[model samples]
Target: MIALLIRDLRLALRAGGGFGLGLAFFLILAVLVPLGVGPEPATLALIAPGILWVGALLACLLSLDRIFALDFEDGSLDLLATAPVPLEAVVTIKALAHWLTTGLPLVLISPVLGLLLFLPADAYLWLILSLLLGTPALSVIGTFGAALTVGLKRGGLLMSLLVLPLYIPTLVFGAEVVSRGAQGLAVNTPLALLAGITAGAVALLPFASALVLRINLR
Candidate 1:
């Protein structure tokens, strides 16, 4: 399981597709925000938190299929099922690898994108911090969505349908943290709520992903 995690992370990093695609999606969203909401700097700042949160959510969506699609196609997934570790452990590792590849870079780069959106100076730190705290849960949740639809021909859309609604609370509180911070208000309430959601997802998603993996492997 650890081996699989290492392999996936190395391949994703070397190929650059994981980070490239996610960042591109994030950048595209950031670029579009001004167009959608008008170019006034104040309006841009007003909406920046929501924009970043939405971009991050969609970026999470964009790379989600890769979590298990390549392995399932190449038969590594099949081999993984027969390995000694628990499927849940394997899924957890895969989720972690996916987060490292697709999410960590996004979190790391979010501040730059936040600046592009005219985000308030005060909120910039919270934006990056919120993503760092919240995005692992996005990957963890995305893995379960990936597992549920790994083998279906039309799974991609279904994966979005399944996982996006689950992302709402994280999105809400994550953006709220930045929004509050921008106004020089109390930020911890929403930030703490976002953390709670992440903890809940991490604790629960692997087991759920494992259940679906078992069903798919059958």
Candidate 2:
């Protein structure tokens, strides 16, 4: 499982393997939104949390297909399925690799992006905390979407359709955490909810993803 994790990370870092694509897209979204929305600091600050959350969510989608597509294409997935490592563990590791490559960068870079959006100074910590709690769910849920679509050609659009609805809970709670934090309100409710969603997704989604991958592989 560790070897598989390392291999996936290495693959993601390779050119054309989707390591930087999501980050680039995220940066572009942050840069373009300010240009399009005008320079009013108040207005930018008001929308910053939602915009950042949405950008991170969409950026995650950019690499969802890559989670399984390359391995599926080269027949490596079949080999992994038959290996001693359980498919559930493989699915979990794939999600972890996705988070490390796509989600982690987004979390790290979000503060810089926040500055562009005039995000409230007090909100930065909550923004990072919310993203830290929420992005693992995004990766795990995205892995499920990828597993569902792995055997189909041109599945990226379909995977996005399938995954977006599932992403709503995480997006809502995550954005709410930052919004309330920025307002100096109690964030405990939404923060707890976001953390719960991530915990549940990480704990349970890998089994479902593995089952879906098995079905698709067959």
lDDT by residue (tens digit), candidate 2, 1-218: 78988998888887777788899999999999989999899999999999999999999999999899989999999999999999999999999999999999999999999999999999999999999999999999999999999999889999999999999999999999999999989999999999999999999999999999999999
TM-score of 2: 0.99
lDDT on C-alpha atoms for all candidate structures: 0.89, 0.95
Task: Show model 1 residue runs off by greater than 4 Å.
Answer: 16-18
Worst 10 residues of 2 by lDDT: 11-20
Predicted model with the maximum lDDT:
2
Q: For model 2, what is the C-alpha lDDT against the true structure?
A: 0.95
How do all models score by TM-score?
Answer: 0.96, 0.99
How far off is residue 156 in model 2, in Å? 0.3
**Tens digits of lDDT, candidate 1, 156-210:** 9999999999898999999999999999999989999999999999998899899
RMSD of each: 1.3, 0.7
lDDT, residue 191, candidate 1: 93
